[model samples]
Target: MVDVTELEQRCADAWPALVDEPLGGWRLRAAGGFTGRANSALTLGDPGLPVPQALDRVKLFAAAHGIAPCAHVVVGAPVEAAVADARWRVDVDHPGGAESLVMTGTLRGFATPKDRAAAVAGTPSPGWWELAAQANPTTAQRRVLGSGSRVGFGEVEREGVVVGAVRGAVVGEVLHVARLAVRPEARRGGVARSLMGALATWGLEHGARVCALQVAEHNSPAVTLYRALGCAEHHRYRYWVPGA
Candidate 1:
């Protein structure tokens, strides 16, 4: 079984925040409000202080950074209870859905798609950025998207045009996958699966054996696709905010 705490830490490392700090074992992250994962406090472990005190620091950190005070907490975990006891309620208005699932699969066992032609590259190509960003990427988005120590970018092209893109980062033996996008015209094809395979191959060479990803619970299509790839939910987490 995957260790939830360790896996969360690796996920954080893979998709790093531009400004991250440690409050004991807890991670306070901020990335200019780029994405929820990069901008929330990861309340997964002990903070070496009273839970209430740690919660206070979380509020101060977010206030100082001009981002909403949010906590990335695992559902049913001890920290979740502690956070709720401290009166931090779930953020119903969270930009990203309030709940998400972290799924894991062994890279070697990932389903093989027929069109495994996503070209893997060490650096993101212009076309890759075009599809992934859908517009000029902000400085914070660019930094976080390209920040991992061992990152691989994958894209599929057709008729000299990019149709799909994905990003993967390797930390320890796990490959953290994110930012998968497929052009509307290319949907229902093997583009997504191909991208996953290509990135998995790249991740293997970079010392990753398992693949992990976070997807919103409400994204049925994504949930179905990942399930088809033999991924199983390792855990679920919710975003919490200061309660009324």
Candidate 2:
């Protein structure tokens, strides 16, 4: 088993490299946080251990940490055995998948202004910024914006007045999809997709070739939409809340 302290340091050190892979962002960062014992005896990235062993290593590490595995993914291995432990929620798909379904797909083009306006008018939910602001009106939104990690690209309107927006980031060769917001009355008219396309286009122009984001696996409708948009699975993760 790895040392808990070392695990913390390793996770931090390894984070920037990991998140650089498109779908990495604030929500993904939050999902990546560590809060237990350390048994990160395995390595990730190039030349890393094979998938089966890696899963075993992660599971062991989770047990050592006293938390169930948060996100467990397996390829080239059986799914049932990997998910046998009670702590994690697991997902399995084809090995080295290309034809497999996407968990977070890359959007490949830019959105037109007309498309952006229409999307803002039709988006269905509040973004992380709005939700954060609602949770604590004074600090979160400002803190995130202040980090210079976020960029806004569209306008949102409510009651015939602009009130919602979309945000994203361009990091190296990948563009991270950050937030999409729309007033409650406007929920299903391709707003989110338009916002995603805008970011993807921005990334390509800025020297990026990939755009990535994540969503709940159970959000079937969203998974369908992303797949239809040409996104393929990059990777997936899960959250292991401490208790009920």
The global C-alpha lDDT for each of the candidates, from Candidate 1 onward, is 0.89, 0.40
lDDT of 2 by residue, 7-30 (tens): 222332322321211121111222
What clash pairs does model 2 have? Answer: 37-65, 105-231, 119-191, 156-163, 156-164, 157-162
The candidate that wins on TM-score is: 1
lDDT of 2: 0.40
- How much is 33 displaced in model 2, in angstroms? 8.7
Q: What's the TM for model 2?
A: 0.50
Q: When superposed on Cα atoms, how far off is each prediction in RMSD?
A: 1.6, 10.0
After superposing candidate 1 on the true structure, give the runs of residues whose Cα lies further than 4 Å from its correct spot. 111-115
Tell how far residue 48 is off in model 2, in angstroms: 13
Q: Estimate each model's TM-score.
A: 0.96, 0.50
